[model samples]
Target: MLEIKDLHAYYGKSHVLQGVNFEVGEGEIVSLLGRNGVGRSTTCKAIMGLVAPHGSVRFQGEDLGRLKSHQVARKGIGYVPEDRLIFSGLTTRENLQMGIQKMGAEALWTLDDAYRLFPRLQERADVKAEMLSGGEQQMLTMCRTLMGNPKLIMIDEPTEGLAPQIVTQVGDFLLEIAAKGISILLVEQRLSIAMRVSHRVYVMGHGQIVFEGTPADLEANEAVRKEWLEV
Candidate 1:
């Protein structure tokens, strides 16, 4: 239920996202794929309002362009940046607790739910976040955002720098998220996981969408992969 139209963003004089357009339907997993320096991350930042946007970003029919990042989160959108912004000093459990958006409001996700998704989090419940391994930290970051019970979550490069086994866990987690009816706008570099989990994929190039299709459709288009996705 997220729609971005004619989106554009700049870093001083440099234009990062130019006339970008896409939408994420309810409970759908949409992946934004491209090689490095192609504005994939910038698109996420612009939609989250961390970057100044020059076009329309609408969520469930409401304009998000003018809103602040926290404001956007409150409007049922959660963002997990590529950096995995976890609280280094907080305990694993405490870091998860920090993601609680509503005290008593009914949420689709809970602490126990998060623990069940990844038992390692429960095992190290009392450990500080900084002490966790890279994969564990990534899992923590994602589960923390889910605590907000977002209608749509935009995760930027969820599998980056993790071990292959951890990457598979992340993929399973994405499927579980979609099974629970949460929409996902996944910005990923790893095509295997993205292709496996995404209902549709969008390939970006030079700050624009170059290809939009189902996973099967994308798999059949070798040229698109060679030009925009493959290194």
Candidate 2:
């Protein structure tokens, strides 16, 4: 459902994405993997039109490169930033309400659906977001994004800084979302999480995609892993 070609982006002359190219099919979970500072986050920003990019981004055949961030969002792309930036002072219910797009009620995700996916959110409806644990915060973040009813969700580092049990929960949640036909573009530092959840993987290094394959393919190819991912 998403295609990026010859994508080039920069942060004030420091080139970040150099001719990066990839695609995510409808209902597919694709992982964009790499070590720190390899342009994984920049790729997400460029797709959302948060950065100026000299390339083509086609989402469901619409030219995305020319659209603004809000415009792109309106076209059914939701972004959950890496930081899980929940409003600390707001109640969990209130924080989720912020993700409700201006669009009408016909949108795919509803408050009921979000609560169904995350029962904890429903239980803590009146609790302040800041009082939640790290895992709860991440669940709140994901549920908040789902409230937008996006066709494709770009999740950056959803498992970062969470306990292993929470990581597993997040992975299961992603799988559930995918089963409901939501295409996911996942950026993750944890290779195991990505491998378990992603149908395909794209490895980036030095601001470009150097490898693209299935999880097993990536595992067998030690050279690429060692060069691009190994610490």
lDDT agreement with native, every candidate: 0.95, 0.93
How far is 56's C-alpha from truth in model 2 (Å)? 0.5
User: How well is each residue in 1-231 modelled by candidate 1, as lDDT tens digits?
Assistant: 899999999999999998999999999999999999999999999999999999999999999999999999999999999999899999999999999986555878999999999999999999999999999999999999999999999999999999999999999999999999999999999999999999999999999999999999999999999988877
TM-score of each: 0.98, 0.95
Q: Pick the candidate with the highest lDDT.
A: 1
Off by over 4 Å in 2: 102-105
Lowest summed lDDT window (length 10), candidate 1: 100-109
TM-score, cand. 1: 0.98
**C-alpha lDDT of residue 34 in model 1:** 95
Model 2 clash number: 0
Looking at model 2, the pairs that clash are none
